[model samples]
Target: MHICFICDEYPPAPHGGSGSSYRDLSEGLVAQGHQVTVVGVYKNPQWHGGKGVDETINGVRVVRLPSSPSWLRYKLQTLSDRLKISRWLKCEHQKNPFDIIEASDYGGWLRFGGPAGVPTIVRIRGSNYFFDVELKRNGDPFEHKIEEAALARADFIGSVSRYASERTLDICKLSHRSCTVIHNAVDMDLFSPSPGVSRERGLIVFVNSINPKKGIEQLIDAMNVVCAKFPEAKLAVIGQDTQKPVDGITYVEKLKQRMKPEFLDRVIFTGRMDRYKGVLDYLRRAHICCYPSHMETFGIAAIEAMSIGKPTIFSETGPGPEVIEHGVSGLLCNPHDALDLADKIVAILSSDELAERLGTNARCRVETLFNKKHWVQRNVEFYERCISSNSHENGRCGCK
Candidate 1:
């Protein structure tokens, strides 16, 4: 089957979980003798400059369009992205028709499916309404409408987690729609236990952007208690800092300003590591990893840590419970409660036996459920159903 993924954050360039997951799936699809292409309008000017990029990496074709003009209004910019993507798809379809087009549900990019005459699957990575609720703010009504339209047009709908799908449907008032849950997976071969890299005794690592919703503030608060309990304890934040600051001061500086004087030097921010070169090595070296997100649709970073056989502490919120078995696979903490988070961190750090037990369980769980090979097959099966249903000229979605 021929498949095209519409996304802005494909790997080799900087990207989040969605991009990483798509790369794993796309590359896997190619390995299985399927044709796969990734088309996107990258935000980074340095990536493509004024011209579009057409290249093949590891058997997958990647086409990156130039960034939209930064000066346009937010809605106008979204329109520009939609038009550019639609035009490209239309042109590409005319040359050699794609079997299916899959796009993340962040923006209404798949709303152009009617023109391309290809069945589309909108995988809910994240939505504006979902983020607004996470951050406790009134979201843009226009963006909400855009998402509603896109979901309505999707020939099939999928989500990374049941929690994410349910929340998106409820918030978007599309509870009647049928959505499939396919957990985002990691490359088990690349992320398995690394005996060559010795683990640091008191080093705790956190991966994700420095943002409030990520529960970094709570992690910082927990670190204070952690540092006091174990004087040598230190936190290594391994992600990019947010472009804008929360108040006048940057988020990292704010975290520093709020830290206790004695443990001031304990927190280290290693801004955005390369996924292949840096993240795996960081996970391999860490004694324990934590992703205390206030609201995570799916915690890919947490799974990445778990894949590397780390004793991970994920938040009890959102899909954490679904992904992990609490005390079995990994520990779950109340991200909102600093003491609870600290206690979990302290538990794993204080006992080598407990850490090894949880780490072993964590790695096994990932291999059993979240391996890339399994997910890639699942995606192909799902896409085939979507394409098959579309060929029948039925008005309803395959998921329905």
Candidate 2:
């Protein structure tokens, strides 16, 4: 089946998890011998790629358009043309007339389908309502209203976690079909256990945007305690300030201002990692990893860390706690309690036997649950079902 995948983020222009997930899912679907077309906002500064129609990537033909004020308007903005979206929709219709349009997030592009005549499948990745919590925490406001319209109208809907599934219903007010939950997947091959170098000082790592929702503040506070006990303990923070780093708690300065003097010296910020392999190398080298997120639709980084056989710590708040049973595959802690996280970190680091046990369990879990084949196949089957239902409902086979 030919599927048209639409998202604002994708490979070579990634800013967050949705983009990362799209790249992996697209590649996996392609491997299953399905023809796929991707429509993404052009985000490259060097190529300045976006919406002016389309471009090609690997084997997937992509339509790139102007990105929003977040930057790069001249090359891809639909605002000035105003009627451009209709033109692009017509162009896409002429090209292949997508059998099913799968979107990320609820009701964003009203142009996709349903009453508009196309079978639209919307996948709700974490939403802007999530931004509301972070925004209020930082005294900010709405930023993605344009996308919100697209979400409200899609014919089919999905999310990566139950937390997201529940939140979508609450935000859309049960007006649309309830969301289907499909957990985000990881590349098990690239992330599996490897011989890694451990820090003699015992390092703890956190990968993800330095946003408050990720609970970086809490992680650092825990590190503060860890540092005091084991002054030799170091902290490495991956990812740049993708979301303004919680107003004042820049992971770098969070260490400087809030952390004790001795602990401050051990903190390192590998700002805005643009390279995945490099970050993975860092994960392999660390003794422990933690993501005490305020909320996680799916804790990809935490899982990725576990997949690499690094003993990881997940918060009791969102998807982290859900992914691993306490004291089984990975350790769980309060998302807000620094001391609790630090204590867990110390215990895991202090016991070689315990670390080996947790790390071994993590590897086995990913092989069983998150392998690329299982992740991709499940989503492909789900997409197939949506397409099949659309065909049956139209009173014709695969047509309007």
Candidate 3:
């Protein structure tokens, strides 16, 4: 079966969950002996040789279209480009007809898929309702429109979590049967925890982009409290500022300023990494993993840390609560509570026996939940079903 992926995000230029999520799916599909082509937007084209057409990289065929000025300059424009992507794919259909088209997000699939006569599935990353909750009101109408269309028009829909799946219906006013929930998979080999892997007295690793929604500020505040007790504690941050620095809104800088002076000095920023090498290296070097994000649809970083036998502390929201079985895998604190996070960080760092036990279980959990070979087979079977369904639909000549 041939699968065409219309993904809004991909690696080197990060767009959070969608980029990493599509990468994992692409690799898994290839291993399962399926032909897959990805269409994504690249922030900079010069790095990819020539951008507007097909280029194979990392064993996956990718076509990156030049993102329009609107897509590049403003958030609203990016969400509004489903028609643009639809037109691009429609033109490409002449060169080679796609058997199954999968849109990893709402914007394009919502606008593009039905027109193509292809059975389209838009994998919901999460619902924009969270964005509404964050803003204390509804999100942008343009963003809302795409998600609504995707939910209404998609031949089938899948979401990252049950929470996200249900929320999709609520936001779009669709039925319960409208979407299926498919959890993301992890590469257990890369993320398994190492036993007795102790670093210097207090090394805390905080990965993910340095943004407010990620709850980095709360993590920093919690670390401040924990650091006072263990003065040697250091929090190593392994992501960069995702947005262009606005005049008065420097989130990362603000975090540093608010943190205790001594604790802030211990916080090392490694910027955004192009690949997993830098992240893997830092994870191995750290004594513990601290993730305080509230809006994570799935906490892959924390899951990866667990696979590596490292005990992780994360929030009680979304994937965090789903993955960390509290005291079983690691500890779960309130999403943005500084006091709660501080207590957990200190407790994990102080206890060698507990950390060792949690690390072992964490690694085991990754094997059970995210085994690569297991997922590869599942994806292959799913692709076959999608193709079969498409063939069946096309051949139907009931009432003319």
Candidate 4:
């Protein structure tokens, strides 16, 4: 099957979980003898200078379009960008028709008419509404409207988690049949426990952008409690601050200032490590992985840690409970409660047997549910179903 992915972030781009997840799926599909092409937008001025580039990365053909913004047309920029993407897709489609064009909800391109006639699938990796509510941001009303419009036109919508799917449907008032839940995959081979890397005793790692929604403040507060019980315990924060300061100080700086003088020495902030190697390196060394995020469509970092056989702790909020079985596979903490997070962290640290049991269970759970092969196969089947359904409806495989 021939598939094309339209996403704003891809490899070598300032990406988060969505970018990495898309790249993994595309590359996995290509390896399974499927033709995959990715159409992405590059806007990072520092890296690519917002210039278009076409290249093949690990078997997947990636075409990046320049997204250099024009302040003069700021209000109409989104519409113009969508038009530009649509034109590019049309041109690409002429060269080689795609069976399915999966456009991510990240950039709201599908809200406008996507490539004309292509069976477009809007894969929602947390909609704008979800982020606005979760992150407590008053986003542009026009952007939300644009996303709603795009979702309405999608032939099929896939979400990384049931929580995400249900929330998007409720917020957007989308039809039940339009969206389906598909959990994100983790590369088990790449994330398995490393024998070469020695684990750090009492090291608690948090891997995500240092932002309020990520529950960074809660984690920091929890660390204070954690250190009181276990003085040897250390917190390794790995990720950059994606958002600016809500107050006068940046979140990173605020965290630094908030930490007590004594406990400050126990905390280490390694801002934005190399996702490919750096993250895995940190995970391999850490004794416990804590992801107390306020909301997540699917917690990729948590799963990655679980895949590495690390006893992971996630917030009960959002999709964490869906993936983790509380004390069985991994521990779950209250998103806003620092004491609860600290208690959970202490529970694992105090009991070596419990930690091992949870870690082993987590590894098994990831292998059973979040395996890359299963993810790729599920996506391929979904694409086929969407194509078949489109063919039946339009007397062809393409959208009308």
Candidate 5:
């Protein structure tokens, strides 16, 4: 089967869950004897080679389209971007028609309805509408219209978690649309526990963008409480701040200001590390990983930590409860409650036996359910189903 992905983020261009997961899926599908092509947009074309560049990375063919700075002319820029992406996909389709075209829902790709008769599947990765609702922002009316149109036109839709799917429906009022929930998978071999990296005692790691939606402020507050009990406890923050500076202060600086001087010294910020190398290394070295996000599609960071056999704590909301058994595989805490998070942190820190048990259980759970191989297989089945359904509806196989 031939699969083509349209997304704005891909490795070496920008880092995010959608890009990383799509990369993993593409490579895994290729390994399984399926042909894959990816068409992605780069925010800064100059950072990467000038503009349109087609290359194969890790056996998957990738085409990178340069996007004009959207901030300068938001509406015009995105409209131009959509047209360019559509044209590229149509040209590629002429060469070797795709069996299925899967696009990330982030950039409103579904609005164009994809290449002619191709079965376009929009995989939900939290759209602007979902983000605005989560952050309590009054989003642009135009953006909401674009997202709703895309959702309506998409032949099929899939999301990393049921929570995300439900949220998208609630926001778009697409109660008639059927959304498939497929959890993100991790590369176990790459994230497996390493004896080479020495684990730091009483160390906690939080990996996500430095923003309020990620609940970083709440994590800091919880850390203050944790430090009151264990002075030596440390929190290492990883990931970039995509938000603009608040009140002339950077998000990182704001977090530092909120922390007590003594507790501040115990925290380390490694702002946006290389996902494969720096991120895995940090997870391997940490004693515990915490993802107290106020909103999440699937909590890929938490799953990556779990893959490394590190006991993780996630917010009780969203997909956390669904992914973890709470006290069996991992621990869960209320996203808005610092006291609850602090207590969970202390419990894991004080009991080495409990930590080990949770970590071991987490590793087992990932291996059985969240491994890359299983993810690719499920996607293959989904693609086949979509293709068969579309063909039946059209009275012929559309693929050339």
Candidate 6:
């Protein structure tokens, strides 16, 4: 089967959960003897060489398109990208056709609809509406309408988690649309535990964009408490420091201002690192991995850490519960409650027995359920179903 993915954040370039998830699925499908093409529209030409650039990475063909002139307004840029993406799909379909086209619900890139007869699936990797609601902010009305139109036009819809799907429906008031839940997965081969790699005794690794949404502030607050309890307890923050500077001070500096001076010395910030080399090495070295995000369609970062057999602490809010079975697989913390997060961290740091048990169980959970091979196969089945259903409908139309 030929599968085409419309993604903005494809890897080798900087990306988030959605792009990484699509990459895993795309590569897995290629390995299974399926043709996979990724159509990515970039806002910045620097992200991909100019425009209409084509390359094959790990057997999957990738086509990159520049959305619009960078100088244009944000809305205008998005509108242009939507039209270009639609045109690309139509032209590509005319040439060889795609069995199924899957797009992220991130920016409603398919608001104009996809190829003339292709079955399109808009996988909910969180939408603007969903994010606004989660973060308690008012989003642009135009974006919400565009996203709703995109979802409404999809032949089928899949979500990374039930929470994300349900919240999207409620937020969009899509009474008729039903979403199938398919959790995001990680590459176990690349993220597996290396028992020989000695773990840093009191090291806790936090991997994600250093923003308020990721509960970094809360994690910092918790670290203060955790450090006091275990003198050696330290945190190594790994990811992009996205926080904008305020009043001539950087966001990291602002965070430091609130920290206890003694505890401050232990925390280290390694801004944005390569996933394969930097992030993986840190995860392998850490005794514990924490992703206390306030929102996640599906917490892939936490799962990545868990897959590495490091005891993980995921947020109780959002889809963390679905990913981790509380005390069984990994620990869950109230992301908003600093004290609770601290206690959870302290519990894992204080007992090596519990950490090992949780870490072992966490690895088992990922291997058993969230395995990339397993989920990629599931995606193939789902795409086949969508394709067959579309064909049947077309047949009925011809008969009529």
Q: What is the lDDT of every predicted structure here?
A: 0.87, 0.69, 0.71, 0.85, 0.85, 0.87
lDDT of 2 by residue, 16-36 (tens): 877787778777777778778
Model 5 Cα lDDT, one tens digit per residue, 1-400: 9999986677867668888888899999999999999887677765347767788999999888777666758888877777777787788889999888888777687576666778888888888888888768898878877777777678888888888898888888887789888889999999999878888998999998888888888899999999999867999999898778978988798889988887889998998898878988889999899999987878888889999999999988877887888999999999899899999999999999999999999999998888886898999999999889888886224321
**What is the per-residue lDDT of model 3 for residues 1-400, given as tens digits with 9 covering 90 to 100?**
6678877566645467677878788877877677788886554665334447576767788877766564355654565455667776777777777666777544534554533556667777754654565435657776677667656666667777676666556657775555656667778766554455445558888888887777888987887788889877888888888756678776677778878775678887778764457887778777888888876667777877887778888788766767779999988888668998989888888898988888888888778776665766665566567667666786223210
Ranking by TM-score: 6, 4, 1, 5, 3, 2
Alpha-carbon runs more than 4 Å astray in model 1: 67-72, 114-116, 246-248, 395-400
Poorly placed runs, candidate 4 (over 4 Å)? 45-51, 134-136, 245-249, 395-400
TM-score of 3: 0.89
Per-prediction TM-score to the true structure, in the order listed:
0.95, 0.85, 0.89, 0.95, 0.94, 0.96
How would you encode candidate 6's per-residue C-alpha lDDT over 132-187 as one tens digit per residue?
Answer: 98889888899988898888778888999999988887887875686788888888
lDDT of 1 by residue, 1-400 (tens): 8899998888888788888888888889999999998999987777676688889999999998986799998888888887888788878988878888888888777655633457788899887768887668888888878877788778789999999999888887889989989999988899887778999999999999888888899999999999999977999998988758756778789888778999988898999888888878888999999999988889899988999999999989888998899999999999999999999999999999999999999999999999987988898888887888778876354422
Which 10-residue span in candidate 3 carries the lowest summed lDDT? Answer: 391-400
C-alpha displacement of 12 in model 3, angstroms? 2.9
lDDT of 4: 0.85
Measured over all alpha carbons after superposition, the RMSD of each candidate to the real structure, in angstroms, is 2.2, 4.1, 3.4, 2.0, 2.4, 2.2
Q: Which stretches of candidate 2 lie above 4 Å from their native place?
A: 42-53, 68-87, 110-117, 131-149, 196-201, 243-251, 395-400
Candidate 1: residue 43 Cα off by (Å): 4.0
Candidates 3 and 5, the one with greater TM-score: 5
TM match of model 4 to true structure: 0.95
What TM value does model 1 have?
A: 0.95
Per-residue CA lDDT of model 4 for 314-345, tens digit only, reads 98988988889999999999989998999999
State the number of backbone clashes in model 5: 0
